[model samples]
Target: MSLDQPAPPAGQDDSTGREFTSALEDDDVLRAEHVSKRFGAVTALVDVNLHLRKGEILGLIGDNGAGKSTLLKILCGFQRPDAGRLIVNGEEVQLRSVDHARALGVDAVYQDLALINQLSVYHNMFLKREKVHWPLLANRGMRRAARNYLDEMGVNIPSVDAQVASLSGGQRQAIAIARTVYSEAKILLLDEPLAAMGVKEAAIIMELVRDLKRRREVSMIIIAHNYGQVLEVCDRVNLLQHGEITLDKQSKDTSVQELNDIVVEEYRRALEQRQRAAS
Candidate 1:
């Protein structure tokens, strides 16, 4: 954003009024302002403010219990914040449930994938929202749609009719993502999508993510432990620590080594603080 360009009026879009994927062109599709959440006496988040651009992928990184999961749950409508607001497409909206978030084009694919191993790829793709044609189900239509969607997205799988259990880890991950994409989700929250995959499988998933980003089909928030991979795939990266976002930088502006050093230093400082408090 240029200093001379001036700011958009309060709660109003600028004169551009166009949508595009480039960091230079797109508008913020999602915003969380002064968000806070707590579990019992534990504070999970503290006045956190974050935003997702219309077509960029945002990487979320944090150590355990750093409020990452809590924020994700709130964004997905699996949980609500004790304070602050969630703005979608510039409108302040309350997410009543996961279904409500989905209706507003926000969806999440957790690490578990939420897929039934016994079900076929196509079956899982159209789960809960199946197509019908009067007396019988539109199995043929669904199969075709699933196959085409996967193909278009460059997700390689042997057959749409094949059981998900029979597919490789990468294929299964692709299926999970494809299901969300097919649902027409505009913003996708992918929690640890690359977890527990071998190099080849991880590469495949990375390619799939790149393909999605290339197409500008959706804005994404990806939580991952691999800082290198996150930097490789995301447009911007944010670090959550002590229930707040402590660092935010464009991927092009930072490196994995730098990020790691920052995290390590933070951990050292925290350890010293704890030791001092104990004394």
Candidate 2:
């Protein structure tokens, strides 16, 4: 749904005509209720419920097989849940495909970035949906739009015509993000956006994220392994454990030590379970 559309309560808009803005001050733009998914005999998610509020960054953190990617894929419409419903802007929706999710103002930037190395920055910006003038791609119009978008996002690059392969890692990441936001994405899913970056480069991405939050135009869900970075950038953090969200807390309400304690306790429980089975 477009961010500008007035939000109504899940069932109220049809009956009482109440606005969604009146639902809650921290309105949930997206919600996954009792979502579950499985592959073969393996359960990937189990009744996982999550909510992303408007204009806030939510951090999804967990160990390697903690179902973070699985849930992210479901949210991005790359995979459908075996059970449960997806609510977008207070209405239930069945996302048919990635394009459907994008049309609903949902987009994701995976770790690979999906950028064509040989393509120029401007070309990549307008990759999927290029501006067309009659029978030709409007190169000039696209270039101008790309420049303005990059500038608006505070991304510093030498030239929009430069090949992505020639840019630094941080610059490439920024360009990928700019392209997504330029497409009018309201809920952005970012998978490890700060991975494999130097201190300064990571800082650049963090600052950009902070700026995005300040703009309050897009809500975000960032997947990262770094707890410190998650606390620094996200307003709230959700820890996925055993295929479900076991921890959800405001960044300020939780600390690194507390987060570590939870992981340690989980480890101990697993060890005890294994010992009991062996006995």
For candidate 2, the lDDT comes to 0.89
TM-score for all models, in order of appearance: 0.87, 0.87
Clashes of each: 0, 2
Please list the residue runs of candidate 2 whose C-alpha ends up more than 4 Å from where it truly belongs after superposition. Answer: 1-26, 275-279
Write model 2 residue lDDT over 31-56, tens digit each, in one string. Answer: 89899999999999999989999888
Cα error, candidate 1, residue 61 (Å): 0.6
lDDT of every predicted structure (CA atoms): 0.88, 0.89
Q: Tens digit of lDDT per residue, candidate 1, span 1-279? A: 433556666555544443212224337888887899989999999989888988889999999889887899899999999999998877789999999999999998877888999989999999877898977779999999999999988888999999999998888888999998889999999989999899998998889888887785699999999999999999999999978998889999999998999889999999999999999
What lDDT score goes with residue 11 in model 1? 54
